[model samples]
Target: MAASGQRRPYPQLADSPSTASLLQSTETNHRSPEAAFAQGPRYSNTQSFTSSGSTSWNGSPTNQGVLDRRSYQTNSVSEKFSLPADPAVWGSNVSPDFQEPDDWIHNPDPKRDRKSDRGGSIVSYRGLTNLGCLVVLVVGLLALFAGYPIIHYFTTNQLSNLGGFNLGGINASGQVPEMIGNYGLIDADTPSSAHTYKSFADGSEWQLVFSDEFETPGRTFWPGDDPYWEAVDLHYWQTNDLEWYSPQAIVTKDGSLEITMSEKEINNLNYMSGALTTWNKFCFTGGMILVNVSLPGSSSVSGMWPAVWTMGNLGRMGYGASLDGLWPYVYDSCDVGTVANQTYNGGPAAALSGGDPSNGGALSYLEGQRLSRCTCPGESHPGPYHSDGTFVGRSAPEIDLFEAQVSGGVDSAGLSQSAQWAPMNHEYIWDNTTGNFDIADSSVTQLNSYAGGVYQQATSAVTKANPDCFDQNTGCYEVYGYEYQPGYKNQSGYISWVANGDVAWTLDAGGMVADPETEINDRPIPQEPMYIIANLAMSENFVTVDVANLVFPTTMRIDWVRVYQPKNAVNIGCDPKDYPTAAYIQQYADAYNNPNLTTWTGDTSAGGYGQTEPKNSFLGQC
Candidate 1:
């Protein structure tokens, strides 16, 4: 019989050298394919097998062939050929339960795919997106908060330095200064003194008593024939014209007296109707008096002579008794010529000339002897004359009042001396012992006594010799040879000079003079308060017919009147308590302090900086 177990050669598996070495080294541990393929013999000439029990095969060629065939059948059927086993599977020597190794069942140490693990989670991506959004929000908010104020500062034009309501340091008082008004009447049919006070009613307390009416002696067409009456007649006089009786001259309405004058009426008259008052009527010491007048239309260039002036009552010569020295008298007349050189030959010379030639026909004539040939011992004479042809026509002259106030102890009612005029020249003096004003005693031979010397005079020598040189049309001649310089037409004009009263003095263009002797008779010094007076005079040669009628219904307007005291005379006791109060101060203070609240930073801000609070850096430091 032949053995059943046999070995057979198997082809080697193809592999790299390293894999082949590994497989060879573990060959004893692994099952060989050749050994499993041979199944008929256990031993052969080229193969061998080992088993627990074996059967031996001894035969010749036929027996060997049979044994080989049987072995092939065993190998094919029981081991390799029985079933085509998987290459991954191994057959066990004895068939028990096939179990997987512990290494295969256990996880392969978590294959650690680094690439897959590196990919972050959804939570991380969300967190990154949120952070980016937060950063953007913060940047946007910062931009908004910082940009608004910068744009407002540039559009306005406010200045930086002028911050308050106060103009530098000056303060404005809310009230306007006071201005006075005119109070009078005009009427040609009434008496020249008709407007005079019977019992002072226009803010005054006194009565006017006239010694006489407008009258002239040795006069032709004037109300009186006496040339001496020419003085008063030259002024406004009653007329029989139908227009003279109108109430326009004395209308009292509202709180004032309205006096009106027509251009035509005043054009025909020699003088405008007005009034005069002296210390003799009333007494005022130191207070000022204001007069206001409004011009009719725009006639400011027309000659208006409404005046408020003063005079002394130291001599007597009719109304001329008040005329004392050549100074204040000549000075008041707007004449600049010296009294010393005004004598013609030996007497006072006429200042105007030229008119009718019959009877030495000229504007005016002098009946008195020339100064050079006169045997009279006095320094002056009076013969100021005027003719109708020489009248200043169409030239309207108006006067408002002769207002006077006194300071000397002498009472107006008890005035010792007064002014007066004569047909020729004469002198008048005041006697303190007698308390009377009189002309120097004609009996006196030497003219040295205070009462004997020549004092005032008016001459009519001016004739055709120089019509243009003198104001012939206006009878009044330059007492001092100075010409009349006309001022604005409808407004008040002035004529000034230097004069002598109790002492030497300067007369302002407004006819104001300071009489030092009026203070106290013995001291002969000016007092704290002096008297003032103003009057309109139309003498012989000074009358003009063209505007004589216009003198009625005419008006004299005084814009204002003022008296200035010397620097030393100002009252020092007055305080500044009258200044504005604290509340008023604060009102302006608020305006200056917050100029910018109403507008842009630069718009309302004074200076150059924006309107800032008290604590703001730029403005606070300044």
Candidate 2:
């Protein structure tokens, strides 16, 4: 009978072949756990009997099954066990027990090494380097684009402020009244020597010598009829027993004081005309001085002379030894004549036209000579006759006085000199409103003799004869149309004339002569401050004024005087010890030392040779 509660199934090989083999086998492997368990089964009476002997199955022992089963189970349960290859598996052909080659485990093949390498990639380093470079480049470009405009804006703004210092404190707001009082009218009648001229002590440590006295002997008065002659003259005015002669003879009245000249007076004072200096009086080493003068009433006259100029403090005149010496002389004259015939009596008389002589002399004379005509007349005395038949003249003819206010140190060559002309006449104008002069009906004359016109002969002659005179070596003579006349021939080294308000004449002693082509020496350079002196002249040779029947006390009034200084020297103030800078002196000294750098060749071709250098350049050269 079967077990009553539950019957357990007998453990058996399910496969028929295995069961038959097992039944037929005689010995059983006892090494297997399954065989052992099967053998331990209590007392037979279960589903099957346990085998105690070895059994065989189809040429192999069935016990191997138990061993195989137990081994497989053990392998399946092991943590470190690996799956055995099966014939059905795709890559199971590889031997499971075969050891890996050393090359495969540690030193991979060249091709495999290259393919598997994932370290030290150059791409990442290159990328990072490129990124850094790009960042730097971007930053640099940004700075360049944004920084320039900001710098320019600030630089220009600062430069503009610096430029204003040249005008000596901007606009002349409160300076007008003080200037007028300080540089106003001088009583010509009063003897400067007698009336103690008050020299102001402005802390500049400056002293005055001839404050109220005239260097020359003469009395200045005012004109009665015409305000143009606000200042007049007196003849034979003996001051301190010195016989003072009047040039113009008749005296007139104006705001200030002036003295007109007759041919006789001009000739007498010829020695004094060219250059005058105030070295002894003021001792001004460098700076500027301004003088105001009124034009003569009668423009219709030849040899009308008026001038204001300066010379070296050393006090010398003419050319040759005086000019070559350390102390030289310089002068400024207003006159007219051909460059070849620039002498008092050398050139052909200038002509006049347009107005009638009945009113005041020859209209042609007034226009051509007195009006400051620059060009030579063609054919006729007053020229070939313009549509208006008027003579040409230089509407503006005035002298500018420049001096060294302070001394700049000795140059590299150890010579004290002026680097520039403190007072330049560029764009200078006469104020007709407040003075005895009038420019209402006046016309400006082109002082440039080189301009194409009839003045070619004069211009060419002057240039050829003068050469590099008038500091020409330093290009100083280029400032004025006329060259320097270091050895001027004529008595009046520098002279200009106005004839009957129609004709004008400018004559230089050193200028070329017309017929014979004679050369005149140039006046010497000046080194001191000089005052302005403008006057009208009557001449027995060419002009005659009826002073007996004319109004007494005719006057010539000065409007104003203006002094200009170099832009660099402005606001330097008036300090005597360091009056002039080393740089300023060095500039002029260098120019003086180097002949090539300072020399200027005049234009001898055609009518274009009379052009002068600009005032600024002249200053720079000095």
Candidate 3:
């Protein structure tokens, strides 16, 4: 995360020499676990293998068997060839005049030394010189052995860090594995036929940074208006959608928050529904986000475009800001807004006839997404002709973990048995290559279905044909996770899309999208802090009128929304098995599922203009 303007005191870095010396001195009384590291040929210790007084045992040196310099006589060949008494050795004879033996312990055969000695009894010092070199070599090796891994893990910034250990807790290989936990699986033993669930081998220690189990109202929020998300009352929320967005559409009870859409008259508006957002009330730089959900709406309902996504908070202002988050530092024609399909502002938003300003709700909060437009260089899309072009759609750079365009078509296979049309599950992202929102870096992926056992391989276009994975109408209960800005060996980040505890696919910083012609860096990789927005959009008239006008009680049931980071943590209280959508909702069908006598704490003012819920409505999970 870019450092906030706030200054904080940090620990000083250790001086290199001092740190190396300290590492070398930290000798252990117990045998070293790194015996192999120390004994390698390049790191051979200078100490001798055997001492003169002790018989060869493990064939290694011991202080107890070291020769006594005071009693040693070089005249004896055994004494001469053995450890030639060293007065300098600790506990050995300390006589200052004690002449160190020459080739006594090193060369027991006098004939060998006589051949080299040109002057009276002089001996070659080569062995002694080499031993000295090895001593220095060992010191250098120890310094590198102790310090390199730590430095490499932090500074080198390797890509493997994304899947390996770089954050959270260290793994057996000393790298932080990319995955931390698992969620959403129906069959215990599905064939390892495709991709089976990948377990967190060492288990998870990731701390829950944010969680909205939907038991109680959360920190202040809403949309349409904002000192932060004020109660939605989202007038004409977007694209002439029929539904009037109101807080009533949201119900936080029975251990879950159910957002319902129905045909009802509200404030003179024809249809009514709910929407929730964390706008300014909460936003984070990077972390893992999970939303356990089940789409209860019929795909036959046509216009239902339910989504769970995260977008850059800068909105349209990021186009002109500097890295410090200050907007308008650099002026571009696109900043004010662009001509529909006309200018070279960055993307084809103008050409697409999508997005705000051109579509009519310019100043609205949800319409502030200019960052998701198509900005490929040299590609100029003509104006859509209705208004001035900026970004063409709700193009703000985002991580769309789960967005279903419920097509109302079912593939009769596996769990579906017969009656459900599978909705297309999508995962879309922008590579933010220019350090800001650029559409050239954008790519969209759509999965065929949310089949229960589809854990391993992503359900790509080719794989979607399998009836087991794409059966949609039977909206299955499942977990969706988005790991954002994962660490890289280069310190840059990427995003990973996970389904049922296994990775579906991933996108890196320099990733290429569908359009290969554009340079890889043309996309916008969202590095800015982002907040979560989970809403069921009618997509405003995008659905056929028949589906839009269809029925009542249309709903998007969410089990929970949780955010976690790499850290020490404990499990949340809700048990996925017993407290499933079926049991929990079924058990509390008659009465609201309130918490067990505990007081719920949150913004009581935002709710209950005419009513209110108990403090702890349902969940005590944290």
Candidate 4:
């Protein structure tokens, strides 16, 4: 805290709870969770600790960052009780167990916990000795069972010191308090007050597993992997546009990285830029992925199409063989150049003879038409569609975080592409989830602006559509978030993306906006991991005219990119609709306590929703 200009307040031992008060709280709060959503096959229980006398750290407990799950006792001398002070000790937590370890002699372990039915069980208390010690412990137990509201009130509404940087739990209450430092995760320090903390928006403790701060400048990003990035060195690549990508186009200079869009005559060709991706090697399923980038300071290369995007691997099993033919999945991206909003299409599409199918300047039949669902009968491609209004598992493939038409018009209200400009604001829609791949779903909405007063959700699409992110942060830095789900949001898996402390967007079950509508109940959801790509291309295929000045150099300056997931856990599955509220992400936190032990799924867009569910069906028939 001192490093960030903020200092941790000196603890007042006199104001602290008595040792007996803490021990009692531990016993009363020993009730287990509703159910154990085991994260893995078998927990190692490798964590070991010894508590002696009244203090926390005593004997030799491994310093691997694991906390002693057992309760701390005052009477149990020679017993070392590990307290939750550091972030690693917090990660060492596991749910109280009803069953013994994989190996045992016979009787159920006295320390085993069996009360959990749902929610997250972060700690466990077992060993207690003597009547005096037990009596002192009972005092603390009374505080939890009887004085819970009072403790919660102070711990939450009081000063940040009450929680120890708001993440520690060794204070007055002496309970296993929530670690809510950065983004509400079990942070060791207040993230906001510390620049050392990356952008982890989800209110959960996260362990940074990957990062590219560009601190070393030209050094290799992912050494020993498939390489820093798989450069897309090709002229006239897939987008019949101009420009050839080269290693020379990508450079890490100054304090940040730059992917400049400039004109270059190469191999008898004229346009040139750079494109790179961490394919296969550094692909991630779900985590807070954010890049602090300032769009080109000047819109000189208006004709250039630059993007920070990601692609799904539906066809990884075999080209077009995975889900029959679902290849591209725009999990979440931002084209800081030219592109029309998918719903209220605008821009040049409305100008040069319906140049932009979405913009109203010259509305065409396709742009003016609005449909409930896509792919009807012989219609192979998807058509205009709107959000289910209810969200119920609806997700967008392309979560365009920040896409702008540099013609120099739209303001930052829409991240420089507000709705007034049509096809320019933040947009999300289920484009093609299954069948014909012809735009199957449309439930599109602009996530950037606070319409009336609702922001997009980061948990489940079936929840409320409007959430508030304005109060999420207090800096000029932009904030966005999103989620990605697998086949069944409840069963398959889901990944969350938080940027600048807000939900950019979510791709549930491998579904993407502008792609097919894939859900958990039914439909085809992605089953493979997706890779990220950052490129500076020419001409966003959606439009024709240039957005920036045609004769100047424009660069996309990215300060850093940080990716993080739950500490000590991977993608743990759960049915948020039940047990806990559908939107409360705390259940997701339970996944950390139980590593590799997830088992709960309802359905996907395939055999469920439109395929089998009649009342809940959005599309007509299977």
Candidate 5:
């Protein structure tokens, strides 16, 4: 240790003038050697250590550590203080000063002097970059505009011939094939099978316009109770049926329209059953109708005549109004004044050949004759008009979708309670020569035999070898469909009767025979809007068994009825008319009051003249 006011001898570091000056400063106001050593050296701006001593640590003119001023010294204190001394600790008397080279203390890879990673050379091609982007945009546009439509066509539009392998060849057109009467085996297992009937023979889709699944448990069918249909309560004098139609016999229960017939006395009829109709509420011109029905009683039981059919809207069921003018006339040539065969005065009139247009009737009569040449009483023809205000003629042309009758004693016609013949697909047009409706067209292929169970008859050809699944009783529901396309004013049109999607029967408008006086082949195509009627009628004409022996309380269940039309086709309903007007009620009361009209004896003016029925009856038009 040096004296308190004296300087200590320092090591001689190589030729460091700055270190010598730093050490000479420490000689003034000198701290004790122990105090100076403990305080260490102050760090300079360059992070090198320096001291204000009488001599530099390197024994230079100033006291300073021998370190490179260009960079920081990162060595440990022991390494920095390495000196040639026996005890090399701090404050030890070291040997002569020796400065370390800049390379030893200056880091070769200092963090601040590192090279950057983003030093690659940039290449430029302006035209090539633009062209590549344009090509990508064009490909995306093509995929959106051209490729999308092609994919959509293949996915949405079904084609039968392009691939040549013939998928759905049996019914490639997707026109419903005439289904076998197999009680519901095929359809019950697959509810989606109904979609198979949603197409036409022309490969067009059918838009469902009306459908009633009968799903509501307590939905009623009385006049104001239903939106689309109504139940009737009357004796069907047109068919001379034995059963009286009562609204109470119709019910919606357990997801079905259950129409039960029982032995009862009503309107002088011993048996009572049910009937439902769309009538004036919902009528369509030309469309397809599909019904799922299980007919009441077995086919072997006689007096069982259950039918699902359509009649011209001009005639109301159970009403004597316009019964003569609209009962079976499809063409204007069969109007009342037009002379045709008739049982008008209890027998066929002789040579009723010419239309007496000079003779006309009331306003109701005139509107009913709008399609005919007959003159009426007023200019306000009170037409039960089409929605387009066209004259809706009073002609009740009939098309039977399905009509089952037990016409034999012991399944002689090969139609038992379990198995039956093909349903009666008959189209009745007025016959001028016969004074009544004649079966101008019918689908009775090879009648008197039960040979065609078939593998889904898609065309008109019958397949007879295979046994059909028609063994189920009346408990099972079967699908029956009818499709009609009207002609364009004497042009050709088409009609088809389908059973369970099979084309059981098909006929062109030209195939139907119109009245000879009409002189037009397409006149019998039923161009007028028609309403639907479903009834379980009891008729003695087809009965081969005793009425007392036949089962009582027989039932018919209708699962649903759906009406569809070709997309964008002309679908018109009955013209708007205030039904059951005071005038109409008066006319109906007058008719009912006439004792000669015994069929309407039960009706009364106080009872609103049957206006209290499931639907009000129009005096002249529907």
Candidate 6:
């Protein structure tokens, strides 16, 4: 209460001394609140206490008012204050004697996680540890399951004779099936279908030079094994071919020569096939060549190409020696003196008559010569020099007797998977004036403008003409023949492609237009000795090949190959005797009264260019 009979403005201590006087006493003495107020009496709402005794605020005496030095007491000095022990009321004013319950934890073994130990096993946790174990188990299972196939793929011979479905009733081993018409085993005793050409064009009789019946079964020709024919072992990188030529792929079985093409990986190549070539052993100039063959797979078998062709002997098979001889050598003189697109030093008289303007009209007599004899740029002299001291460096002049492939562009669009069309033609280098060859771009720059025929697969004509010739899955064996006859000097010549006893295509030297620009009219036939090559290749040039659907272990079967020639026909080969002498060649030139038909000054035409003299082991007679 205030002296003016009004309540104090600030919150007053209910029954204690004034807050101002108490605070001042405590601050001055620096004593506890209880110590500073020790002389005063404490009071509650219903009771009060004095230093004399406990009393009521209304001046009434009460024994219930009890107190202790540290805390308020009820009945006895040991009794605590009668109030809830909530922290809100006690706050920071709690007596120093008060104590709280202990909540600190203790662990003797701190290294162990006791909670996890009591929970579950390690497998129960779904974590990276569990994931790693699962992954390892899966990988192990996959490896175990795939072990056999991986090992077999790497170790086994995929082209083996065993296993796989039948191809025309022949297994992967390429056994000769029953002769269906002329398709099966070639008979050694009988004359071939090409025997009809015995009476060659121009009233000449044919004589057999080389013939192979392949009668001995189980005979195999490995690389460098056979005297006449050797298997080619290489990847034909020049053609972007997908197969590696393997010697083991060529085999003679059941009286037939079988060339197998299969899905076999070697040297990073995805396929394996066979090629048999009579390279350095035997080569011939102008003659009649006949082959009886059954190509592997039809047009449906994409990327499959089977060919029997002749190449200039100077070019080694699979060796990239094309600069030496790749075919189509037009002018014998590859001198740099000649200008481009010009008529042999810009003189029509000189170009046509074998006289060079640069040579002061002197008759070198080597104008229309298409021999691979020039020392052109990058031309290597892989040679056997003649008696006249001129190396026989001839590689141009190619004759493709048979090349089985699908047609190109719209022609192929009209063909079915069963139809196989082959092109029989000759290729010449693009150099009409200079015989230089750009071997790097040979494919696009070559010329095939002469007598050529697309293979029309005369199965009906063939089967009708010869009852013995039967058509099978890839069609029956057909007789493919090429007859080339050298002319009288630079006069008219005769070359014909025969199919089933009929001339399918012919190049009449007389019918050709006399044009200086297009040298094809000059009748540039393959004059040099060309060796034979037969291969089953997977080429991407012709058709889009479905590699996934290609049947593995397919085969190309060859019944027989027989070569014939006329007696008067000048057939030059590797044999030194077959080589024409300068005087002998001049006889024909003089008869035609054509100076361009004559050979070069020192060129004897005795042997082909680049022929090895001491290494000439060719046993064939011209």
Best candidate according to lDDT:
5
The digit string of per-residue lDDT tens for model 6 on 1-622 reads 3323522112125464442244443235644433322333333353222233433332444322222312332232222223335644422346655444344443233355677357665665577678889999998888878976797789996542112212222211223345432222113434655443464457567756566777667766674344457787777765678888988899887767899888988879888998898764556667788888776754333567777777665445565423222323322222321122123444444233322334443322212222323333232333445555544433344566756554332222111111111111112112233221111123212222222111111111111122223222524677776677644225545456655544455544342223343232332444456678999888775456767666777887888887776655535343323332223223233311221222222233531132221211111111
> Model 5, residue 409: what's the lDDT?
47
lDDT accuracy of residue 584 in candidate 2: 22
List the candidate 2 regions with Cα displacement exceeding 4 Å.
Answer: 1-255, 258-279, 283-292, 301-304, 316-443, 448-553, 570-622
Worst 10 residues of 2 by lDDT: 412-421
- Cα lDDT over the full model 3: 0.38
Write model 5 residue lDDT over 470-571, tens digit each, in one string: 212426667776787766225646666666545565555554443333232224456556778888877764455457557878887788887777666636
Whole-model Cα lDDT of every candidate shown, in order: 0.24, 0.26, 0.38, 0.35, 0.49, 0.47
Ranking by TM-score: 5, 6, 3, 4, 2, 1
Angstrom error at residue 379, model 4? 29
Model 2 C-alpha lDDT per residue in residues 1-622, reported as the tens digit of each score: 3223322224333452331233332234422322212232112232342441343322345555445445544543351223334643322226755444565567534464654875756679788999899999988887788767777777784432122212222111112122222222232333434333111111132111112223323332222221112222222111111112333343223333344332233323421111122211222222333343333322222222233343332221121111121221122222332121133343222222211234331111111121112233332121122345433211111222211111111210010111111111111111112221112212322232221111111111011111221110221111111111122344423323221221122334333222122112222222122223333323332223344432323233333332322223322111123222223223334322222221112332421222232111111221
Alpha carbon deviation, residue 31, candidate 4 (Å)? 99
| lDDT of candidate 4 over 296-321, digit per residue (tens) | 43332234454565543221111111
Model 3 clash tally? 41
Of candidates 3 and 2, the better by lDDT: 3
Per-residue lDDT for 36-69 in model 3, tens only? 1222122122344332434332344433222322
- For model 4, the superposed segments whose C-alpha errors exceed 4 Å read 1-202, 220-226, 297-302, 313-324, 329-404, 410-501, 504-521, 524-526, 571-622
TM-score per model over all chains: 0.21, 0.23, 0.39, 0.38, 0.50, 0.46
Q: Tens digit of lDDT per residue, candidate 1, span 1-622? A: 2344444322222352222233332237643444334333343443233431342334345445455646654654454334346543434433334433356557334456766456766678789799889998887777677554554556555532211211221111221113221111111222443323211112332221111221212212121212111112122221112222122232323322233334335435523333232221111221222233232211211222223443221211122111212112222111112223222333322322212233231222322111111112232222111232111100001111221111112221000121111111222222222211112222311111222112222111111111111111221111111101122112222221111101011111222122122110111111111223333222222222233222333443332222222122221100112111223223333322332222112333342223222111111121
- TM-score, candidate number 1: 0.21
Error of 6 at 38 (Å): 99
Which candidate leads in TM-score? 5
